[model samples]
Target: MRIGVLGTGGMAAALGGAWARAGHEVFVGGRDGAAAEALARRIGGAGHGTPARAAEYGEVALLAVPAGAAPALAEEHAAALAGRTVVDCTNPLAPGPDGVMLTTRAGESVAGRIQAAAPGAHVVKAFNLVHASVWDLPAGAFGETPPAVPFCADDAHAAERVAGLITAMGWSPMPAGGLDRAVYVEATAAFVIGVWWAGGSPRLAFPEPAHPSA
Candidate 1:
């Protein structure tokens, strides 16, 4: 798969590296062309000038930028992303002295906002629950087993493709249903953030259920 990662941050680096390792073509883009090139060099992928170019070059475009920047970015790449699957990995994180709060409402989600901006794109909400460190580890780093990463999207085919990509990254993919369910998933991100605050650990993961015997 040709994947375009739009961000030069830790999460973008982690995921882009993993996808490159998995034999996929990846193009990373950012505001600064030099920084994007540096990130691509580090991840062994190509780098592009603008988000629109990256979106045009990829079969699936992963938006790993800050959540607040999503709408504008989506709008910028709307034409390029037409009829494409866009995997949204952003969380509506509102930061302040008090800490981070959910910027999205109880019934709305970042994925939906991006979808609204690019109505032609199939937006799937995922990878927001896990830490960037988890994506940096090897496939067997979590022992012989690993945890599940839950996601949701309105389009079934797009969701399935994204799920396969998620599995290839050494994590189990738990489909949490339609895109509307992203509201709950975003809420869960807040829940996970709370847990991290209380436990003082940002490396925790949600356990996957074992398969039943046939």
Candidate 2:
């Protein structure tokens, strides 16, 4: 698989490095050409270039930029991104006096906006729940069991492709319905961020909500 990473940030480096280690070709792109090239070398990427070039180089592209910048980046490379699977790992959250605040409007997720920006691309919301440091761990990152990552996508094929990538990177893919449900995933990220900020464990909050009676 050829993967393109559209940022030089932590998330971008983590995922790109994992995929590269899995024997997939990768390209790291960023606004700063030098930073992109440095990240590419660090991650064993096949190449490095501008975001547009990254979009053109891969069958699967990961948008790990800031949430506010995702739309413009997507729009700028819409032509190259068309007909490709685009994975969104952005969380629209900022630290506030109270806790983390969601930057997106009600009912609108960063992934959704990115989809609108590049209407022809298959936008899948994923890799937003966990911290980038977690992705740096080996196959069994979470002690005995690998963590499950919930993703939402309107395109079944694209979803499956992204799921495969997630699995390759050592995570269990939990499909959270279609793209319409993506806002929920984004909200989950916000909630999780708040929990971390408050020094609480988000994992403890997620259990079998209710077990069915046998």
Report the number of the highest-TM-score candidate: 2
For model 1 the local lDDT of residue 29 reads: 81
Candidate 1 residue 214 C-alpha distance from true site, Å: 19
Predicted candidate 1 versus true structure: per-residue lDDT over 176-213, tens digit per residue: 99888988888788767766766655454644459656
Q: Per-candidate TM vs. native?
A: 0.89, 0.95
Q: Can you list the residue pairs that collide in candidate 1?
A: none
> Which regions of candidate 2 fall more than 4 Å away from where they truly are?
none
Question: Which regions in candidate 1 have their CA more than 4 angstroms from the true location?
Answer: 95-100, 200-214
lDDT of the structure predicted as candidate 1: 0.84
Angstrom error of the Cα, residue 19, model 1: value is: 0.7
lDDT of 2 by residue, 35-128 (tens): 9999999987469999888998878999989999998999999999999999999999988778888888999898999999999999999989
| Clashes (N, CA, C under 3 Å) per candidate | 0, 0
